[model samples]
Target: MKIAVCGFVMGIANLIPGVSGSTIAVIMNIYERLLNAISAFAKLKPSKEDTTFLFYLGVGIVTAIFAGSLLVSLALKAIPVVTYALFLGLVLGSLSTIIKRVNKVKPTYIAAGV
Candidate 1:
């Protein structure tokens, strides 16, 4: 159930520009498990655990993708500014999560790159 919900959030994240589904999975701390489940399909033998986990996650992701598309489309049509602001917030939130994981920041690195 928890994994399903995480999948749902990941789905929603995918709907917005600049938000990655994998990044959402990483934020939820299921990135490695998700990756393993995906890679399992390519192996000669796959485990029941990976199959079951992917099933629930896939269900959530597919459900949200369909539902969120309609809702997000409506929101965008009705209130473009608010919808964009919400997307910006999602991007910023993801950025902060990434920043939090950084062990150190170098002034030169910041200065050297875009």
Candidate 2:
């Protein structure tokens, strides 16, 4: 379920401009897991478990891409502000998640980074 949700978030991130699905996975702290799972294929030596796990994330990403193209884009076309709001929410959510990852998040450092 978590992997599926991450895949969905990644798909939406990709669909939206100026957003990175990889960044979302990094924030979600699943980047390493996904990297291992996906890299196996490129390396041409995938383990059975890695193949199964990636299959799930792949299904999720593909499903979201299809749904977003079909439904989300249609609605976003009709209501453009909705797209902005969704993007804002994703960015804000990602920022919050990133802050949590730090041992002691510094406002000055974050401000500088931003």
Candidate 3:
């Protein structure tokens, strides 16, 4: 159930531009386990636990993505301004976390990016 909820959150996060499901996984402290599970599948030797975990996570992610798409579509049609503002807020909120990962800053790089 917890894994499903985590997957659901990740799905919702992915609905937002610039938000990655892996970032959500890392925040939830399940990134390492997720990688292990994927690696197991890659080697075609997934354990029973990994199979079950992936099943639940996949279900949650797929369900949320479909449901979220509908809701977002409606919100965009009904209240486009509010919906856009909300997305913008989400992007800006993630910027602080992303900026923290930067070890160094170069003025030329920043200027070039801009």
The predicted structure with the larger lDDT, 2 or 3, is 3
Q: Is candidate 1 or candidate 3 better by lDDT?
A: 1
Off by over 4 Å in 2: 104-114
lDDT of 2 by residue, 1-114 (tens): 777878887887788776788988897778998889878888999999888778777777888898877776687789879877887887787777777777987799879877
What CA RMSD would candidate 2 show? 2.7
lDDT of each: 0.88, 0.81, 0.85
- By lDDT rank, best first, the candidates go 1, 3, 2
lDDT of 1 by residue, 11-68 (tens): 9888999898998998898999988888888884569999989888998899899999
Query: How much RMSD separates candidate 3 from the native structure?
Result: 2.9
Task: Please report the TM-score between candidate 3 and the true structure.
Answer: 0.80
TM-score versus the correct structure, for each prediction = 0.89, 0.76, 0.80
Q: If the candidates were sorted by their TM-score against the true structure, best first, what order would they fall in?
A: 1, 3, 2
Q: Could you tally the backbone clashes for each prediction?
A: 0, 0, 0
> Which candidate gets the maximum lDDT versus the true structure?
1
